[model samples]
Target: MKISDIASISDAQKFILDLYPNDNRDFSYVFGYATRHLGYLCKSLCKNSPSVEEFIRSISWLLALANKLEVDVEVSLIKRHPDICPYCVVAPCKCRWTGKKPAIGIKAYKIPEELFYRAEQIKREKKADFQSHCERLAIIYPGNAYKWDAIGPWQLTSKMQEELAEVHEAATRYLSGRKSIDAVAEEFADLFAWLLSAWGLSFPEGNVDDSFIEYYLAGCPVCGNNENCECELFADLSTQLVDSDKIKELEKLFLALSSEVGFDGDEVSEVLQSLEAASKSQSEPVARAAVDQAKAKTEELEKLVERGAKNAKNATTIAQAIYKAIENFPFVG
Candidate 1:
């Protein structure tokens, strides 16, 4: 899919699946890739590079992990943030000023009302998407008010690193029965937002969505596989392929699937694209077309439908295997 078509967080997840499906990778493997790219991002920032490419790479891996885990990151973001500061539960967070102070350090601030009424109202009325969440965060924490100019790139990245550490800590606590899974999820959401903020700081004029799609235009930059990356060892990839014909073909298929099946056409197209990217012999489009043929009351439609069902079942089984493999995997960043 092209950059312009991505409108929600699920779209981003599907993009990752297209590039790196749950073929042979486990949850821990994907998690390692996420942290590995995050390390690269920190190095990039430390060296004062103008590129935010590593940041997007890290986000792509994180999305993959979330997909495997069946975590709806958009829903998690909406529940935790809801267009406001999660801790303060208000736009332009007042936790520093309006909330009570129980201590004298960074974790001192505490929300007066744990049940945020306004947050609930906003969640009910607002439709959460990745772009809108980023926009809402910009408003809730305006750069001008937050001294975005004063905070250098290194500082922003430092905050990202700090959030990563907190994610580790939260996971540790959860393992020890001191914290909940939601706490770990919250840390992840915070880290993602911070990554977006750092990207904005690095390239004020660049669009994250467009840049992301452009980076993965030909799938894994290193291995050049759209799905099931073949890179066994870490490698740097500078090549980016642009195939307008492929894009046009995928777009046409998406439109066709939208009319054929009652599923989200973009998602189904992405699934097919993943198979095509890996050069799988099984033709998903053919199977789906047979689905249409089955609608015509053909005699052999039952066999076609069974094949499609098996493919669908295999996909789910692979996803479940990945999930179980990494369900207890710890954050290693």
Candidate 2:
């Protein structure tokens, strides 16, 4: 299914364009180097992380930055699904670690972090929420579905960090290796695209067009593949099993929730709270009310553009929403 590995995508292009970092391509390796450096940085930054909750929260903060950029990090795991490399289709993927073929399912290693592996571990138990068709992906590329556990804060080694720095420098040179001096910086930005992906961050958002997936998920960030900007995206995370009713409630206040892009990190902790509200308000009233609210919002947007309302175009849609609401209020001066 891996859409990214097979063909280019729209969202991916929008992502890369936004990440314009330099003028050249040779220096793009800095992104790859950042990948290796992250583990060490994460280890140090999360040293005081008490429980998995603390760890997930820290990671969510990182996720906030990712969401703003539209990186589609799920594609990162799919791109690196070791099944193709080791041809292993099972948990632990012993073939990757041991370089040996397995009999039935591939054997694997002991993942380090308790938090990151939470999803993967659940997957290992056949409990990951998935579709009947997704099971096919499991059959053909059957193994751990996600990369969270394999890449924990404490999972990387010291030698990896040293090598990452070297890779960063190499990528830098590649960006401007043959191009004009000004082009080097462009290359650096490209490489940074890879670095962010490796960090499980979304690829840059500006790349969202015909050429995005290709640029963001490019197989080789350094050598410059002949298949440049041709990566594919198999699934859309927005459509996946994250409990929509919950998301709708969040989506209802979505304007409000988007206090930060998608939703505020602070509000993420209140996800369960929102979910409970969703369950209680399953009647048509909540949904009908939401539809009415959304319609009102759309009409407001049209008014702003139509009238060229002062301080409107300069404001975000949500800001405009608030502004319009205030205007409609009948409070006494």
Candidate 3:
């Protein structure tokens, strides 16, 4: 089924469960993997890289955790954000200038046919960046005074981190008999809310359900085989070593050329990360394809550099070409 057909958070949770029906992982293991992917999202955000894939992967794990713990994610979300700003009680949310802190309780509302649609509505109405969405949501839901104190990317990320830890702790407590499974589910709900907030803040344009469906409709992304995923066991350390060394050499050359063209270190670093991510496949054909793509990118870079590289934008374009070449080279590492 399409992800848009997922009528509520509960439905999304079930979709994730169906995706990995035989998954015997415990809560800690699931949470750890989710956290790792979330770290990837943070790294991408810090580097100004597009993080749509990272965000979707992280949410999938969290949804799995929610399903495992039987979290009423739908109610949790609707209660906190009932189609309007819970704090200002407005659709568009004008809390920035008004500085209003209305003591609003969670109001009940009929859940939408598609929960993600609510996020899309907010994105269109605000017409602001992701951080603005986080600010509005943070102010409305839970009504934390500290959240409004410093509304920025860092603050939102910090809140997400805090919620992540709480989810972990709650899970630990449940495992140790210190808390009920319901308590863990409650924490999961909080984490899911923060995750949605992060999604809104990071990706303000596209529908997440659409992206999720498109990405996963074709079985596993890594191994491209749903029946038995051997991606982790299929590693070739020797190939990896050779590729790593080659990448380091290419990185040095790219950096030197970028510096010669007056490009800053950050732009070069971002491109290098993208290239590294792209060239991680162990298959010989994919590796060869990556090498060919890298050579082409190097040629492009040479041309761009020779033809009056005036700004970092020119360097960025070259870097992007290298990244695309790497990404299109297919293989599972």
Candidate 4:
């Protein structure tokens, strides 16, 4: 399950379906996981590498939840956005800057005659990949990076949280028959824009498509499996269920990526060895220490990228995500 396999929204949805089939998971479960990763993503907003990795995870879970609900993400995006603001019906929306006083005689939610042709044209276009999807949002609402810079990452993350709440509100409305599913999809599309903005602001070095592919190259970051993760479902975090085989698989991935990041493969192997050994330890303190070591190592490697190490950006993104997953592992005291 490489990133290319899930480049477009439709592709990503299918990739998620392949990894975690709808029949095996319920909507609530999938939504819970999505929100859970979204929470982690928020925490990493100020950190570029970790945030990019978490963004990929968060979006993947969101796609999974959409699949469980039988939502057509690509179609929803097209209908709600249409290469322009759904409300403003114009590219590079001026609603905020213009104080919502759009052109006269044009009511809210109505596409004007001048823009209708372009909107219809965009709808006929093929589904775009993650990078193009984010880029489209940038086009629709330009200057997001500048806005994000002015407000700071804290405010950026806060905006993301707000959008997620709107998604919840929209979903609730649909479930209660107060709104249509299309409305819910619109909110999700907004959330996706905010999320992509967060990623673009922090990590502007490469396209999100490449970053996502790098982190998810091995499929499930935890279990290292392509389809149907072998890791215990995160249904309960209090339980201790460390799988040594999965740990070894993660270690192998780290080793394979060491040279790509200009890091010593032996050092990378040693860090995971400690993590593997600690996962088997009876003392909670030992596992906690190993988690810290892995985190410190991840940070050090990221610093190497900061120091201009070749190709470290792609490799360290995966390293950050892997360590974050380890830190959040269901380690019991």
Candidate 3 residue-wise lDDT, 1-333, digit = tens: 344466444566666676555355767667777787776666555555636777778777777677666675555555445456544555555556457543343233423323346656654554332234344555555333344334545555666677888888887787788998766765665666576676665666666666766667665576665434344522222311235555555556566556656655554566666556534653466455445545555566667666777665656665665555345432322
Best model number under TM-score: 4
- TM-score per candidate, in order? 0.57, 0.25, 0.56, 0.66
The model with the greater lDDT, 2 or 3, is 3
Q: Which structure is stronger by TM-score: 1 or 2?
A: 1
For model 3, the local distance difference test gives 0.58
> What is the per-residue lDDT of model 4 for residues 20-68, given as tens digits with 9 covering 90 to 100?
7777566667777777778767765654335456677788888887776
Candidate 2: global Cα-lDDT? 0.34
Candidate 1: which stretches are off by over 4 Å?
A: 1-5, 46-48, 99-127, 143-146, 172-179, 233-333
lDDT of 1: 0.58
Task: Candidate 2: count the clashes.
Answer: 48
After TM-score superposition, what is the CA distance of residue 150 in candidate 4 from its true location, in Å? Answer: 2.0
Candidate whose lDDT is highest:
4
Give the poorly placed runs of model 2, Cα more than 4 Å off: 1-13, 19-40, 43-79, 82-89, 96-99, 102-153, 157-333
Q: At residue 218, give the lDDT of candidate 4.
A: 79
Q: Model 4 shows how many backbone clashes?
A: 0
**Candidate 2 structure, TM-score to reference:** 0.25
Predictions in order: lDDT: 0.58, 0.34, 0.58, 0.69
Which stretches in model 4 have alpha-carbon errors above 4 Å?
A: 1-4, 47-49, 112-117, 125-127, 235-333
